[model samples]
Target: MQDLLDKIVAEANVTPEQAAKTLDVIKEYIVEKFPMLGGAVENLLGGNN
Candidate 1:
């Protein structure tokens, strides 16, 4: 989400590249740990666009 990315950029004071990587890792963890959710996130993220 753009709002989430904005918040992370401001609060974490990180570069765009770093923020993207961080978000990817966070997403990966969620998918890995919450197998039941499966592609729910991908769908949500896709809807965001």
Candidate 2:
């Protein structure tokens, strides 16, 4: 997750905090819409931490 945040910050030129918030929103939506794939999505996002 940290790595992704960092990459977003670097590549997208966004702050780390912004990156985290963005990911959190997307993750929440995905989990809500696809409950069964939540675990898999989390893994792809880095992990279920």
Best by lDDT: 2
Q: Give a tens-digit lDDT track for model 2, residues 1-49.
A: 7888899899999988888888888888899998998888778885533
Error of 2 at 2 (Å): 1.0
Task: Tell me each candidate's TM-score.
Answer: 0.75, 0.74
The local distance difference test score of each candidate is 0.73, 0.83
Distance from true location, Cα of 16 in model 1, Å: 1.1
Clashes of 1: 0
lDDT of 1 by residue, 1-49 (tens): 7677778899999987777778777777787899777579786543312
Model 2 misplaced stretches (Cα beyond 4 Å): 44-49
Q: What lDDT is reached at residue 10 by model 1? A: 93
Write down the TM-score for model 2: 0.74
For candidate 2, the lDDT comes to: 0.83
Identify the leading candidate in terms of TM-score. 1
